[model samples]
Target: MKKQFAIIGMGRFGSSICRELFHMGHEVIAIDTDEKKLSLARSFTTETFVGNGTDESFLEKIGIRNFDHVIVAIGDDIQASILTTLHVKDQNVPNVWVKAQNDYHHKVLDKIGADRIFHPEKEMGSRIAAYLTSDTVLDYIDLSADYSIIEMLATKKVAGKTLIELDPRKRYGCTVIAVKQKHQVDVTPDPAEPIKEGDILILIGDKRDLRRFREGELS
Candidate 1:
């Protein structure tokens, strides 16, 4: 299903979100105070608005409450970000996500009822650290503090081995949730299926166990 997303900021982070959501076939409204930024976002968003998001009058006029999700991505302006988030929540938007510049900003957003808070730089740093750990790790998503889902490309160490032989769950405390071979995806692959070189594996496990598996076995 498609969603209506309003992104209030046109910085790098906000623009990226707008572009991705638009590409995913969702309705995206990009808002920013800078006309230049809005011009850039116009190509990627369903609509682009040049205005200060902190202005409640403007927000109300634009019918912000109708959006399924509203993202407060005001860059550097902490006060504006908080005010925008508060106003958006007051309008009863179903989901309100905010980008925080620091831990303090995160705490403030938490107190103000942001459904999700993202620390882009910090999160990306952790992801890059994971990539540096092993070439097999293609992508990472944190499910929680202790759990994660990782996309890994099968290498010589893992190729030609069946799940029963590898015994990931018993040996590494991880489970291969899905496997992608070429254009096909096998969500419920047989345990006896042989993993081929260059196949993508979607694995979920405790972070510590995943780290140990990547460093000790896959590396």
Candidate 2:
């Protein structure tokens, strides 16, 4: 289903999101105080506005409250970001997401009822660290401090073996929740199903257990 999104900034982060959401067929309204920034967003967004997002009157006039999601990506202007977020929330926007500049900024946003907060630099660093840590890991998502879900490419070490033979739950302390072979995805695959080389396995496990499995099995 399509969603209506209002992005109240046009910096690199906001512009990238606007383009992606537009390409995904969602309705996006891009707003910024700078005409140059608005120009960049005009091609990708359904609407582009040159105005201060912190101005509640301007926001209401643009129908910000009607948006399904509102993103506050004001760059480095903490006060503006905060006021914009507050106004958006006050208007009762269903989902308000913000890009926080620091820990203090995040705390303020949290207290002000921002549904989601993002630290792009920190998140990208963590993702890069995960990629550098393992060669077989195609993707990683931290479920908690101790648990994670990882997508690992099945290699010769694991090929031609059934889940029963591998017994990952008992041996590696990890669970193979799904497997992707070519374009097909098998969720909760049968224990007797053969795992082929080049297949991708979606596994969930404690961090330590995942590291052990990666070293003893994937390596």
Candidate 3:
């Protein structure tokens, strides 16, 4: 399903998101005070606006309230970012996601009713570090401080073995939630199913237990 998004900045991070979302077939409106910065997004969509996103009237004029989700990707200016997010929420947009500049900025966004907050740089750094350290890990996500989910390429070590035989839950203290073989994904795979040599296993567990699984099973 397609979604309507109002992106309030056109700097590197914001433009990147606009391009990805456009390619993903979402209706995106890009806004920035700088025409040059905003122009970077025009190739993606014609719904580019030149205005102060912090101004409630400007946001109202753009029909921001009607969008399914609004992203306040403002750069550097913490005050401007906070005010823009607050105004977007005030307009009653159902999902308001913001890029947090720092801890302080994140706290303010949290207090102001921003539905979701993220640190892109910090997240990307952790993901890259995981890839660098592991040869089999294809992706990683931190669900919380103690829990994580990871995707690992299935290797010969586990080939032809059934889930019950491998007994990940009992042995590794992790769960095999899904397996991706090429384009097809098997969610909650049957325990009797045999593991293939090149499938991808998606597992979830406590972070320390996941690490133990990596060292004990996926080594």
Candidate 4:
């Protein structure tokens, strides 16, 4: 299903979203105050506009209300971002997602009724911290304050063992969600499916269980 999207900023984050949506065959209206940024986004977006996003008249003129989803990706100027988001919400756009710079920014967006808030910097920091803190954790995604999904390399002890054989749920309270190999990804691995030394296991569960698994406590 295709949807119309409006992106209010042309910085790295907004540009990336515009490009991805366009590549996925969605209609994207990219708006920015900077002429240079608008020029850069021209080839990637379906439509480009140079205007002050916080201006309600400008937003109205551009048919912002027609968009199914609007992303407020304004960088640096928290005031502008908030104003734009408020205007978009006032227009009653069905969904509004905002990129927040910090905790304060997130709180403001939440109070103003943003459907979703993303902190890319904080998320990337967490991912980098996971890599730096442990050698076993190939990737980490925070599912909640106490839950996470971790991609871990199968150690020698776990190689050739099946889900039923290892029984991670019983031992560690975690579930193996998928197995990723060089050539394929198995989302529905059988209970008897064998694990290889180089296979990457995608597991989901409470954060404590993940930490225990990472420290080789459950091996």
RMSD of 1: 12.1
Q: Is candidate 1 or candidate 4 better by lDDT?
A: 1
Model 4 TM-score is: 0.60
Where's the lowest-lDDT run of ten residues in candidate 4?
Answer: 125-134
Tens-digit lDDT string for candidate 4 (190-209): 88978888788899999778
Overall lDDT per candidate, in order of appearance: 0.83, 0.83, 0.81, 0.82
RMSD of each: 12.1, 12.1, 11.9, 12.7
Q: Tens digits of per-residue lDDT for model 1 on 1-219?
A: 466889999998888777767765678899999999999888889998888888899999999999878878889999999999999999999889888999999999999999978887855534533543356988899887679999888888888888899887898999989999999999999889888899998889997788767765566
**Could you give candidate 2's per-residue lDDT for residues 155-209 as a string of tens digits?**
8998889989988899989999999989999996988988889989899999668
Give the residue spans of candidate 3 off by over 4 A: 124-219
TM-score of 1: 0.61
* Rank ordering of all candidates by TM-score, starting from the highest: 1, 2, 3, 4
Distance from true location, Cα of 203 in model 1, Å: 5.9
Cα lDDT tens digits, model 3, 1-219, are 456778888887777677767764667789999999877678886499999988999889988899877778888999999999888888998888888999999999999999878687865434533543456889899888678899998888889988899788999899989999999999978889899988899999986687677767776
lDDT of 4: 0.82
Per-residue lDDT of 52 in model 1: 86
Assess candidate 2 and give its lDDT: 0.83
TM-score of each: 0.61, 0.61, 0.61, 0.60
